[model samples]
Target: MGKVKKTRKNTYNYNVDRKKLRRRAKKKSAPRIQCDEIRNAWNRSKSLAGNMAEMGLVADPNKSLPIRERTVIGEPSKVRKPYVLEGLKAAASLPSKQTMGISSDMIMYVRHMVENYGEDYKAMARDEQNYYQDTPKQIMRKVNLYKHHHTKEYQTLLASRTKQ
Candidate 1:
C-alpha cells in the first residue's frame, strides 16, 4: 500500500473549529428586532416606506392621520330565556294532538284485535306491542283505558259482531 487517505470518523462539522462555529452562530442569531423597533426604523427610513405600504401598517409618521369621528350602530338587546322555559315554549307551540291521535289509534287497533281474537289475544297483543314499540303492561293499560271510556260502544259493537 502506498499512501492511504485519512477518513473522518465524525463527518458532522468535523473540518470547522468549535470557536469559529460558535462565533458564526452568534453572528447569524444577533437578536430579533421587535415590532415597535421595526416600526420606529420604518418611520425613520424613507426607503422602507414602500415595504411598510405593502404591509398596510402605521409606517409613515407624516401620512398617518387619526380618525376624528367613529360611527357605531348599537345592536338590539336580546332577552335570554332558560333552557327549560325555551324547551317548554317549543313543546307548547308544537301540534301535540296529532301525536296523541296516533298513539290512541295504536291502542285502539291492539284493543280491537284483542276483542276479535278472544282468548288468543295475549299472543297477538305481544306481537302487536312489539310492532308499536310498547311493553305488555303499557299496551294493557291503554286498552283498558279505551274500554273504560267507550264501554257502551265497545259492548254494542262486540254484541253486533257476535250476532252476525
Candidate 2:
C-alpha cells in the first residue's frame, strides 16, 4: 500500500504581529474588559458547594448558596456574600462559545431551554460575527493598501472577485 499525504490547513501567524497584547490594552481610556476574557470564577464555588452537602445547598436557581446558619462577620453583619458568585456559577454552566459570543446554535438551544425550562432561567447570549468586516469603502481602502504592497497579487485577487 502507498502512503497517503495529508493536506495542511493555512495557520494564521500571530507571531508576525505585536509581542504583547497588554501594550495596546493599557492605552484605552476607561478600564474595559477585553473581548477574549474567559472567567473561571465558579470553580471554587462548585468545589465548596459540592463538599458542603450537609449544608443542604441544592442546585435550584431560585435559591442561593447555603451558608452555615450563622456565621460572624467582623463589624457589618448586614452584608451578604457578593452576588457575583452566583452569576459566575451560572455563566460557568452556560454553553456559549468563548470567542464569538452566542452562536445561532446556542441561540436555538437557549430558545429551547427557555421553552422547556424556566423563562427566568434563560438568558440571551451576545450574538455577533466573530471576524471583522470591511465596509465597501474599507474594502477599497484595503485593496489600495494591498495593491501598494504587491500590485500583481492584489490585481489578481480583485480581478477574480469582479469576473463573475
Per-residue lDDT of 75-133 in model 2, one digit per residue for the tens? 23332333444554776788867543334553444333323323222121222321234
Could you tell me how far off, in angstroms, the CA of residue 100 lies in candidate 2 after the best superposition?
30
64-157: candidate 1 lDDT, tens digit per residue? 5535543222211221223323444676687756533335666567556556654244555566445675655666676666667677766765
